[model samples]
Target chain A: MPRVPADSQTSAGFDSNLLAFTRELRAEGVAAGTAELLDAAAAIGHVQWSDRAAVHGALSATLAKSPEDLRIFEVVFERFFFRKAEETALQRGEEVAGKDPGGEQAQRIDLEALKQQIATALQEGGEGSLRDMARLAVAAFGQTQGGSGVVGVDVQRIRRSLGLRSEPQPDLPPEDARAEGVPRDRLREFEREVRRELERQTIERTRSLPPARPLGDLQRGLPTGQAADLAEIHKVVAQLRRKLATSGQLLKGQRQSSAIDVRRTVRASLQTGGVPVVLHQRPKRPKRPEIFVLCDVSTSVTSASIFFLAVLHALHDSFRKMRSFVFIERISEVTELFDRERDFKKISRAITSDAGVADVSGYTDYGRVWLEFLKLIESELHPRATVIVLGDARTNGRPAREDLFGQIAARAGRTFWLNPEPKLYWNYGDSVIDSYSEYCTTFECWTAAQLGDFVDALANPRHLPPSK
Target chain B: MSNTPKTAEELASRLTADGYLADTQTALVAWLAIKLGKPVLVEGPAGVGKTELAKSLSRVLDRDLIRLQCYEGLDEAKALYEWNYRKQLLRIQAESADSGWDKVQDDIFGEEFLLERPLLEAITSEEPVVLLVDEIDKTDQEFEAMLLELLSDFQVSIPELGTMTSRSHPVVLLTSNNSRELTEALKRRCLYLWIDYPEAEHELAIIRLKTPDLPAAVASRLIELVAEIRGLDLKKPPSIAESIDWARALLLLGADDIDAKVFRETMSVIVKHRSDLDTVAERVGVKLDGGDAASAS
Candidate 1:
């Protein structure tokens, strides 16, 4: 007989494991269906079983639908394969018991003190470290299924201590006997009671505690765009820049250079008789594309606009030239200020620093802004340049001049509108996004994630980046 | 060639013979695709050597490399199979001049008038062929549908002929730069492999294989500079093919070391974008000129 399970050692083991893992993945909102799972299973035959990276690659190829799915698969794969039951068992063995043996008969396991430790950890450590400690607390005192801190084992000792059943259950304490001899079950009861009490107290404490400042993934779920903290916006810009814009020299790879210089190569071949010893290639890089940024700095979408400009400013090396304009009721150029400033901290102030360009505060008339700009600087706009507009598209019932926007879009290479408001508000109220979206590639970007998608699309405009 | 490594350990060895190296996963996938008679869909960003894998497979397999380079508006007539209409017209004229038009007209739609494209050519070839449908994402959805059918059946249907099946069906490989999202139906039909930029050690192996004559220090410096540039924000990034080309360019210049002067003169070899060149000159140039170590961050 094999020491491990029959399925674990064989290729059949991997197949079942893959199926079960895909099921978990589907439960987690990844759209991995039956056919995808089967494809993933088939892929395992080609890759080395011992090589987890190879297995990951094979599964990612079969299971993942897009680059987003691939990222999810990486996380799911670690949760499924790397964090298995055996490792969890080893971890359980390593966990220290919470009971103090020095005190006579362990002094009924301090529930209040345990709750205090948890509250302090929750306050001091981040969510990641807190979750780890919570899992450890559960493991050491409470009975849990395994390593994953998601669910704890049924609170058997707690139910026993409280005496939930009216009659004496088999192998359980007699209902009346709890009135006499409840002392025998106290050690086990101590473990279970502390976990339950700690959990309840921890929840109450965290609710009273202020929300963490540097928003973790816990706070990333909401679609709060402009409302996000300034530091969070900086984090988002740096992240999006890395993921979407920063093109690596060793990444976007090579192409077959067109039309080898045969005359030059052949002439050089004369050094080794008629055979071409060396081939010469005159490879040329493709011409850089231009981006024209038009930002609206009204009071409403100021934060979003600042981040948009900050990210674009930071990524100026990617394009040939990026001419920036800030508009309130009229437009004016701020390229010189951005050209001088590389620090993002300084950029936030510099964007809204000059009150003159932003028309010195008034009702945001977008039509007037477009009319004023088109009349003065239409010559600067080129067919090869993409104009990106950052606004909420709330025109305050002013004349939107959608046709003027359309004409500008027609003359330029391409047009994109990034509205800071959630897409649910696109056609609602005074949002003229409905009228404007028809003329350009318009989308809602209320968060860094959305902005990342937008930036990715801008970098490679051949296709829209699919939602992660 | 006779002594080519047959096992997994030898896969790297065998592929290295051509100055191209494959990681264990890619090697395993290639071996499996050949053994299992399944099409392998390779997808990645541009310049990661997706097409080079096909060439390497063709070389390793000792088969004719049939490539159907995909583009927009690529229809079945160009991709899979098309009838030889011109040849048919000539034959019709010749047959009518000699025999009656009745027999010639019936035979005009036969296999004699059939013109086999890459897919059909690979299917009908006696020896196993390595069929490369390069840049499938560039083509439209209709071409993908045709590929789905052809890939699944391993044969093509013709009105003139019933169906031509091969005794030895070709090993199919489809590559995409992921410019456009391919349909799920197409991805499900094949084994998948994504080729990324190799790690430092993996890339060094490839560099050594491609430019065997280069000094070790120079190779290290070239890779080091590329890694540094990769960290910078730029428009178009250099790929593996570019690294090889850059290495070749440096060798031609006969530069003994990577210093400010050599890098200043030949910076364009690696940096393709004008803006990126400017950034590199400003960032990397200052370090090199400061009389600091060449490998300064």
Candidate 2:
């Protein structure tokens, strides 16, 4: 649990409300785990409670880690924090009792009867009637974002089984609720209340019915550094890719060549009475940066390094030169392996279980890996190239060849060190950060936010200055 | 005058005086960070002035702005503190050959050879310090982890020299361009602030402030046009810095307003990517040259 700030003097009622709201968010499939909820509570303890934006902004910084999570969080936040539902209800002095208690709300549409009626319509040669009903059924209930290969949406299943439609659109908020001029927060509040009502009714109406997957589940994944399995990690990385792809920042090198250069077009056409005929672009694209990634696939950094590599592969278009190296003891170039295998599981398996990267000791050597990888890339290393070395930096009693790192720092535009271990362990035993600290900036990147921010910087280096 | 801001509004006003127009949220966050003495993690896209805020804070508060520029391979020697190894080695060598190792230990690791990097300097400074950890996401994870200790408690523990604490706590502002996600532990240690591209009006104020000689008509048109270009699905969006550059570029080219020819010639200033320039030019051509043709079509 997050330790509440000592200065906090919030009412007990506010704390309970915060917890209940967290539960609602969790029910909506935002993996806003225990730690995050505690952080949220602590966050609320500060600032004037009357300040809506401050509360929202602080909670947002703590809770929303991804775009989809941000979306769901915004909805849940409106429903919980900014909500006037129960307040207005009590203020009106209206006895809104029962809320149609028991099986009343959930059984409004009987699935068994609806299925039977659709079957009958299909048998009666009124195919259009079945189509209309299916459309209506899907619109009323849930839908799927096709190609996920999960079971069809509950409403779409009866129709798809009858060979009506092959694909369904992604489940989004209702039309009236999604419409503009309604202030999205209010709509989100309405949507959540409606969904919560449906959920309560469904549980009451049919006690034995299996619950449908929440619409927001597709966007949620295992938090960074908590992926214990390989296949699951792949799925999370894929989700991360989708999130990044939808972001406004474009990975510049790909699909950028389509637009013609107009300034050059007008300049060269001055001889032809301002009628531009032949274009005069440089005929070359802007210089793309070379990124050399040296990953420490030591036992400690394996899981995180895989995630780092997966994200790098997902954003492949962002770099002109992308090279990857993995080192446990001896350094080996794994860029070809990553390019060849789209499946991270296959790549991870082949590299870790198959390849003999580990020396006889199965240990990490910061000294030899630094010296050896530099030797490999020294000739080809450009002053503009940015080399990223991801590892825990535990030298394991081997001499930390600090000079080679310094030498690489001299060769490349910049060198950065990413240690998966917490900073507390940076100097513990074999972790020799003092030796390598002189070369480049190091950061604690045990979270997805850090990795995402790193990729964002890589994709948009134009705004940054040349070198430190 | 109170060197420590008494209110968020005061800080905001002072920041504006320093030529940084922080919004209510940014002002509030900065105020809280200052009052609480916690590091403020300022995050946003590039050119949103995350670094500028720290600089402005230093100027406004009348403190030394200590900057630690982060990149890959940045380690303690560069970031936190570096022992003058050559001096230490020379000192040890110059000492009596028969002297014990413990005899010269205090002499080598003392304050003289202790070269304080940004982090150590900020922590150990006698006066007020504003530490700007710029582009923190560009550095490695190890560097990120190292910041956690310094950020959490304004102190550092050295093996040779023992623990060093600050006389006056520095106002630490760590900025990231969303290059990488900083960990929860790190975020939890500080207040968070994110800055987006300013709306038209604020940007206009900035443009006028930057280029005092530019015509008001041209500046408004330029802001409107840049906002439109940003709306387009271009590779690299034009940032405020680019907008200022474009304003300057227009003034140099002697264009009062963004006519087609002037816009076409000066498009490169605002648009970094060739593709965006092409798109902007075509749009201009349609709006300016194909006015009747577009209407007829």
In terms of lDDT, the poorest run of 10 residues in model 1 chain A is A210-219
For A333-378, candidate 1 gives per-residue lDDT tens digits of: 8777778877654565566666465554455788988897788668
Query: For each candidate, what is the lDDT?
Result: 0.67, 0.68
Candidate 1: segments with Cα more than 4 A from true spot: A1-13, A28-31, A46-51, A86-446, A449-468, B1-9, B97-102, B290-297
For residues A1-468, could you state the per-residue lDDT of candidate 2 as single tens digits? 447755546447677777777778788876677666666666666666777887776677556554456667776776564234444444566543224432333336565555445444443434345344544344334432222223222322333333222111123223321111222222223233334443333433343323334543322432332223333445555666665454433534444555568998898789898999987654544445688888877755644666666655664534446888878898988888877887655676678866667988777887888788877888988888988888888887888889988899889886777777546557865788877878786766655655555555554565333433
DockQ of candidate 2, scored on C-alphas against the true complex (2 decimals): 0.05
Off by over 4 Å in 2: A1-10, A23-46, A65-69, A82-88, A91-468, B93-100, B252-254, B289-297
TM values, all candidates: 0.54, 0.52
DockQ of each: 0.13, 0.05
Cα lDDT for residue B192, candidate 2: 66
